[model samples]
Target: MATPLENGFSAPALRLHALDSEDLALLSAHVQDALVRVGDIAYLPAKRRFALVGSRFDWTAEMEGRLERCRAGLHFESVQRVRCARVSRDEPDAILELLAVTFEAGPEPPGGVIRLTFAGGAAICLDVECVEAQLCDIGPRWKTAARPTHELSSSESGAP
Candidate 1:
């Protein structure tokens, strides 16, 4: 339960440690509107860890102005393509909004999978060496080309 900025400037800009399933669940909720490029994912089994970086797009009033410019079909130099899309499981054809990315760790032998759950139930699971992974923030914020449209229904998410 720490903010991405909790550790101060010396931290990895954004990094989480010992994040179990419950931790990931909480993180998914915090990273509500991050952007992810579907094709930019990687999992290296030999390292016993997987790493995925996302642009911080948790939206604020200042970003609203940039979002409007993007909507007007004007490309904002401040907005990088990597910050405008999300990861999708239902459809891998393009970048999609990042709703949540969960890590389910397996027993010894160091194995698990990183599941990137996009808006809706769409998700992409990456088999990794283990649950040792760090999602860091490595890019500037940008206005999304489009906002995702989906609902996280209780019946669908099964969280009461």
Candidate 2:
């Protein structure tokens, strides 16, 4: 059954625990390919690796996204204070609530789910219903930039 969304859209099906370490590692290297800064806009150079910067679960997912964006040269605005988690099976109801609140809809719900494909082509679809509620559930954290594009200084990050 397709769930309701903010723009009347529906996300594709999601597969849980499909991403492996290699995939996550690649993704991590990509996201961190440029600069190691969170809560700010950064650019990822061509064919760079994503950065791995969080728990084994959510970080992998984020890294996967970074891989896609960097490899394809896609661009997006910076996310202010990110708190992520992979809730494929452990929290169905919570995910539903997230969809509702993230989209700002009441009992009926609001936004749709999004498909997130991993490095090896494994895809996971998630919804953002209660944006605020969902965000509250997460904690503040930092994600490194793509390795190759990372802006490092001798006195700052100890690299380059």
Candidate 3:
């Protein structure tokens, strides 16, 4: 089998869209450990959009003895409203580590709540008309020594 690089495949900047639950899951995986400053988040009521910029861990690139992170932008369209919990607006400089993105359907079809969960019990919920979101790598990547890790819960470890 030809190596990925040998086959002329190169790591390119990510530009992805999420139109449904499955797509959102993939997008979430790419941004699993992104670090976002509270000040970077914005909700444009006039445009019906919610956006944020973050330093996203580059999971696609080869480690090559070092980790990497790059600036990324994520946005959701047709957003009706935004609600946050455990994320204080008073602390603009505070950084939050993104954990996952999930969707919960509303009573009406094609409408739902998109939740962005972060470390320290912080979360942002977007009331959206549909699953319409985009994630793009917006800048050059740099090397990093730190890799994010998640501790498994007792139930997840199959232990009593």
Stretches off by above 4 angstroms in model 2 are 1-109, 132-160
Q: Quote model 3's TM-score.
A: 0.85
Model 1, span 1-160: residue lDDT tens: 2222322312123444434566556556545565545454444444433344445454332243433111100000111112112333345345555677665565743455556666654455555544443444444433446544566765444121
Over 4 Å off, model 3 = 1-10, 62-66, 151-160
Compared with the true structure, all predictions reach lDDT values of 0.43, 0.25, 0.84
> What's the distance in Å from true for residue 2, model 1?
17
TM-scores, one per candidate? 0.49, 0.20, 0.85
How does model 2 fare in lDDT?
A: 0.25
Clashing pairs in 3: none
lDDT of 2 by residue, 1-160 (tens): 3323343443222222213233323433333322111222122333221211111222343534532111112121111222233323333232111110011123534333322222222222333332211011012223334322223233322111
Tally clashing residue pairs in candidate 3: 0
True-structure RMSD for candidate 1: 11.0
Model 1 residue pairs with clashes: 86-96, 86-97
